[model samples]
Target chain A: MRAANERVRVAFQGERGAFSEEAAIKLLGEEIELVPRPTFEALFTSIDEGASDYILAPIENSLAGSVHRTYDLLLERTLHIIAETIIPIAHHLIGCPQASFDDVRVVESHPVALAQCERFFAAHPHIKRVVAEDTAGSVRRVIERGDPAYAAIAGERAARVYGGRILREHLEDHHENYTRFVLLSSEPRVVADGDKLSLVVRLKHRPGALYYALEPFARRAINLLKIESRPVAGQPWQYRFYLDLQAKMGDPELDAALAQLRERADEVRFLGCYRSAQRTEKERF
Target chain B: MRAANERVRVAFQGERGAFSEEAAIKLLGEEIELVPRPTFEALFTSIDEGASDYILAPIENSLAGSVHRTYDLLLERTLHIIAETIIPIAHHLIGCPQASFDDVRVVESHPVALAQCERFFAAHPHIKRVVAEDTAGSVRRVIERGDPAYAAIAGERAARVYGGRILREHLEDHHENYTRFVLLSSEPRVVADGDKLSLVVRLKHRPGALYYALEPFARRAINLLKIESRPVAGQPWQYRFYLDLQAKMGDPELDAALAQLRERADEVRFLGCYRSAQRTEKERF
Candidate 1:
């Protein structure tokens, strides 16, 4: 286990104000030096080459569901998960200084953001909605274009970063929308309080194979937060299952259960036990 | 079941020349009047309100996973799947008249399109990739901005529709990239020689629930084309499974298997059985 004052460098995919960056800061804090990587592969490469101490990546979102690429990257990379955080997604509708409601003919944002703001757009039938790559990137586009007719649905922080005014806040249809992020570090941290264990296991593609693979956790009464599956590369009709168990890896019961699971599973990889973020109560302003 | 050549109005979510438009046209043909809906929910509401005869929505793509909202909408609405079509996605890099690769600093398009052209972007690291709501929408932005540095990755048809120049064609990383769209009509369609079945089922959130849910198809030797699971609304830890079966619903064996599956499932809904698109070799050019 690494010491706290080691000046851990964390890498995240996206620009400065991306939601992923928010997750990284929340997990590692201001003390850690942050590194930005353009792609998920680059994030992993940074960790592998010691360019970054850790990589913070999104695993799943409550509304959008699992990010399959992140799961595939986990399987492909040798990095270990040392922590986890769940960030609430509060999408806001923002516009540049040159734009007003009357002048705004089109709204630009990520598809997920657009989908989230469907209800909001329903009222403004005249305005065309456009999806952008990243929330911050959309804000930048609105700034660069300087078009009064163009607005973006992005994060509140993104609006501030890109000098965009907030047209509307909390534009997502669902209030409980949250994205879960996992921190991948080169060195595993010692399991502590609030730690949640994550594991990736490949089971035989046969009846009751999953049942046998999960029996160990069930026997230990270990609560699971989530379970997602992604197809194994180069293998047809086969999948590798990713599981999140709400127990520290250092726990005696969990350790024994994992050993048993390893024996039953065709292949089992420990993705490290990380501290889970405390569920936040919805804030009313 | 609706007879062929009957006048039917269909709603699609997108502007003209959008892939969804192509899918809608292919399914309903020139006989049906296509109503363009700005939002996906409006497409469903149009059918529910009897404003349109049917709706065409995308279910999944080979590269991008399932369109989850569509799945949730299917569960929320009473629309029936009357047909299905698979469209090969050929992304083209397009730009405004004055834009050139050397002058371009930013490339904009849908996230899926941006993801598909990852290798292309990697080679041109100087160009920043931006995402938008739609490929055509991105082209519109480039033209609206009139910036030579702005390029869009869109469909060839979109380039023609938006009057943008095709800077580079066939930019997708994978040649086999395809998107499967589902046609939801007010009434079901009779099974034909090439008909395929689509089913939605909910299983008890037990360890072997998924295995049991898949048993019927496996037992009948039905080729499972796609299987996706979305969280059941208001039910924590529960999932609703969406599947596409290669066998026609009219087949006695498949009918019997579906009946058996319904008995075992918590809730079973037959979306519809419709003709699968004929597989053709993809054009390299």
Candidate 2:
């Protein structure tokens, strides 16, 4: 799908108006072609099959911890992280052309979206809350049904794409809600000045193992952006820790710390060292 | 609601025929009466407000990593665990009168229930999957709609409660899928012979921090049943680890290990030491 190496084709999971798509365009700009996949595996397969040059997926959300499937997929696939971006989420309540507050009976959207808009729904308890596969998919359903009683809670972009009217905007309870997306490619890219390193480490199932695992970062005074753990399969009570540190793998100090971490850890994998995107101004509620 | 100290009133988050209600019954038996709450917070609030003696909540599933909100709520509330039980999930495809496989166009259930029945829906792609607040709630929606084309995937108990017929049984993709429920009470209960201890530990950001965290169990050869992590609010990159160990807190070795773990960890909190339910053979798929 790429005409040249400069124009990378990125694959993401979800429909056209998905926040993931918004993240992809924000990070890569509007020049690159975006391909949508139904599932996370399909996104990785697209990269592995050479159908796309890169894949952009949400790693974590400020409100909803880590996207476990994305982490598991990252561990399963051999793709390299090339960049990262944080997208501010501004959820909106949308409805069909003939729908109004009085006509609406059911509101549909993803569980996460519905949860973020808890305050809005709490104010109007009469409307039935329904969870759909995707936010845009819900919009599509409302359009297809042509039922005035059906509405969805999604992004403003989704409302425009599906030709739905915005019944209410900025419905999320929190203003700091944001989702972090990681860009992965088949080949690695050079880490620029403002790059971040991501690593996954499997430690020995012993006392003080994780303490020793984090010693390197602590000793180096490195700023850790995030740290999470997932169950290590086949091992009854062990876990593999994933961390994001504010230093590139190429940095001498970071390289040294990683080397020390590797010596103490049972297994260590360098997920990637990628340039981090600058945080955009917070969207006002 | 308590007539005597021996009897306790437990609040569960679900309707009358929910699996959660069944879990509450199994945990407390006929001696304790169940107070059903529509939401998880209500269950916790019932305990906090001194309206209930204890609360039984589903913490995790074998297939799902963790019921995250439960973890967050556990951290937010000061409730202590007094007992725990494991429940095997058995999902059933149910529909109202006049609705058959051919006529069904939409299937509704709780998000978790819908996820468990992914394989069934994949085989019948024409049927749209919808997510309701709960399994029994989905059945209630079908009954309220009185639409033959609208079906629901719920538990057999829910089907009977809502006067629906089973279109298909044992719809979960994984035959061995089970959910782990924790019993929370106002005060800690005495640990008996067959008891398990649960703890929440926060480790300092350093290398081998987690390894050191679990050293107590590893040194004494005490079995750890489960370990999961949740982020600490206001502290980016820091986490609080939740662990379930096989031995009770009263055990000399367990006590020593916890002491050492507390010394090494940034913070340590003992949720409770409670009797673990007997493991029953899973029902036939």
Candidate 3:
């Protein structure tokens, strides 16, 4: 920890009132300074540019699955994951403060947000859906336009920040939608309570290569939380598997498993060791 | 074999000259009647709706990975996969026949097509990018507009059918970009040359559920082509894994492994048994 007056600066992609900002605040608290970058490229380079002390990036969503750009950027940068947080994705129809739900004729948002509220769009077929660059930025634009016929789909925080009104709440088709975000820093830090480990492993392109690599962990009965295969950037059809396992930092068993993995696989990279976020039990579909 | 006069009607999603249409013709021959649907839902329902005899759907892309919507629809619909095809994705700058490359100031296509030609767009920053519903449809519209300043990015087939000129060739960032499509019919057909098997399995939430599921195949040195985990509907964090393996329909070893897999997994679903596409070997990065 730094001195009392020194606040950590966290960089995120999108406008000021984006979901990344909410996740960063949830993980790092309100005292941290928010460094909002316009694009993903700018967000990843914020630390190297000395504009931020930490970077908060959205890694995956329950509905959309993994964010491939974040995975690619993680490999490109030398940042280490320090912690993670999950936030429920609640899409609302927001408009200028003077606007009402009845006045809305056109809805605007990121294409994804517009796609997610298919049921609402279907019910109101007359309402035109316009694609915008950013979710929060759509809210900003809607408020700035001050047109009652125009509204945007975004988070509640965006409406508050942009001085917009929530014309309708919970417009998302799925109630269980959630986004998982990871906090990263240039320098690695030790977390005594860390109980999760993430790894990116590349195996030789041969039969049973992945099977042999997972043997060490299987033998130890290590719980695998998630696994994803992503294509290697320069190699077509070849992939690197990303695995999340329940193992704390400094665990001797995990260390032994890593040692065995390194010997069996072509390459193994530790992405992070951090505490797992508490999973919320929601109504099953 | 089709009758002398009775042509097989193949349904695909998009305009007349979409990549799906080209793939359909490449796989089923040019003598077949083409049925074009505006949306994926309509494409999948074309057989049941009595508009077409067969449906062609894109299952995976080497660059974009699996198309999740197609996978979900495959599971939802009772259609059977009878055959498969692969097509190279080559985006071209298409315009009115009289328009030259330098005359274009605006480019339009499906957002994904636009994204794949990032290098070309970056080099020509003066041109504005517009998102359209379909790549082939964009070419149709651009040709209809007959504006020298407007162009669209699409496969060569789109330009051919739409009477558009190819102003620039191979705008795609990667030469290895390809999409794999599966042929679907209401009734299953026996494939004697089938050498590939696809499965969707659900395992109990346990420490080594997946490890045990893969044991039967791993022990036999069977090659696994692809595996993807998708969120189980209604179950927030639970997942169902889809696997593609290299195996024939009636191979004894594969039969034995699948038997063991069924016994070990909570649920196992066989999506299809068909011949694998010819693999292309490129220089290793």
Candidate 4:
């Protein structure tokens, strides 16, 4: 077993000051060694490649819905969720030190960030929207170029990390936007107080099949927190459901419900059992 | 009702030779007037703004999963789906007439198209991938630039429209790639022989709410083709379920099931009942 006092290396997909990196720091702490991978595939295989011990990946966003890439990649790999965290996504207009808000002619950020600030762009129709590979990386590039005409939409951490000036705050259209991330490990984390259970199930292509699978859970009063259907790759229209349930692991009723669900569905995968974080700015690090 | 022989004007979100344009022509034929909108929001409002008679928007892709923007925007509007079409997605490397495969140093295309050709980019590590706004538009720009080093990945139609040369064929990772688009109108067209039904339902926040909603269709042996849950806006963690079923409109059993469903669920929105297209390429334009 690894020592509790040892600093852990966490791998995330992005540059040094990316939103994922900020999330990794918030979940694991600033002392943890952050290993930044360029892509999702690399982040998932980091532990196997002996680069990092664990990974933190975004699973869902309140406004944009689910991150399908993360869900698909997580299922393709043999990883287990150990913990979960929620971070408020606040987009800020960051520019070079000499740039003012009116001096910006081009705005750069990840596609996801740009999409969230649609109203902002609609108002500033003259500003050309440029797509960058990473949010934090965009801030770094514009600052390095020392261009007053270039601005980036990203988190506050990105501005601070890259020493970029904040031209405008709360540039995001909605204030309720938040992203949910999950910490995944190679082994099943023995979560002592885990109350949220995540699983994926493949149902038979027959009428009433899904109903029968949910019977045991509903019958036990177990709250189904979330349910999303994703197409089964190589099968075209056929799909499997991903579920998040509110029940503690090893509970007698939960165990019984799982036993019944296993018999009804063709395949069932236990992803993880972990604590769900409440959305509160006070809870943030 | 308008005459069936009249040439309808159709709007889609992309350039003239985009995959969406290809899909629209496949569904409505070449005689229809094609109106290209710059964004999904504009595409949805084209009818209300009196810019076009109908809009053809992509709903899902086999390899990439659902288009969440289309889903979210569709729910926000009061449009009815009148027809559906599935088009084969084949990515080809297109360059200027003077460019050769060996001369291409940069590949430009929409993020979606670029994502589908991951294997191609992996095989050619020296080629840089740049994200462009549209697939066909990228081809036009690269041809205008007449740069031998610049290439765009798009459908075959783009090559002919912009006078670009096909540098490589079938760059997509999967041969089975297909995208399904829905034709929406301001008023519901009388679709005879419609067999597929699409609807969105909101269930009470309880353990058995969703299971009961599915019971009505299941007991009658109606096939639930798909079910996807998306979070309800303004309410965090709460969701509404979108469903597609294999049942004809006006069928006695379907009507009965829907009535029962309405009584069991909090809210139900009938999106459309239309003829689902077969995936055979022979049925394409």
Identify the candidate with maximal lDDT: 4
Query: lDDT of each structure?
Result: 0.75, 0.78, 0.86, 0.89
Q: What is candidate 1's lDDT per residue for A142-235, written digit by digit as tens? A: 8889888888888887888788888778888887687778888777677566467778988865545665676677666776556676655334
DockQ ranking from best candidate downward = 4, 3, 2, 1
Candidate with better lDDT, 1 vs 3: 3
Best DockQ goes to which candidate? 4
- Candidate 2, residues B116-174, lDDT tens digits: the string is 77688789889887767788778878877888898888777778877987877899977
| Tens digit of per-residue lDDT, candidate 3, span A1-285 | 457788889999999899999999988889999999976778899999989999999988887677777887888898898898888899999999999888999998987788779799889989988877679999999989999999999999999999999999999988879888999999887877888888999998777777788878888999888888877643556778889898877779988999999998999998888878754223222
Estimate the TM-score of every prediction.
0.76, 0.81, 0.91, 0.96
Candidate 2 Cα deviation (angstroms), residue B201 = 4.2
Clashes of 3: 1
In model 2, how large is the Cα lDDT of residue A196? 77
Chain A TM-scores of each predicted structure, in the order given, are: 0.90, 0.93, 0.94, 0.95
Q: In DockQ, how does model 3 score against the reference complex?
A: 0.48
Q: By DockQ thresholds, what CAPRI class is model 1? A: incorrect
Better of 3 and 4 by TM-score: 4
Worst 10 residues of 1 chain B by lDDT: B276-285
Return whichever of 3 and 4 wins on lDDT: 4
Give fnat for candidates 1, 2 and onward, in order.
0.07, 0.13, 0.40, 0.52
Q: List the residue pairs that clash in candidate 1.
A: A99-A148, A109-A132, A130-B133, A131-B132, A131-B133, A132-B131, A132-B132, A133-B131
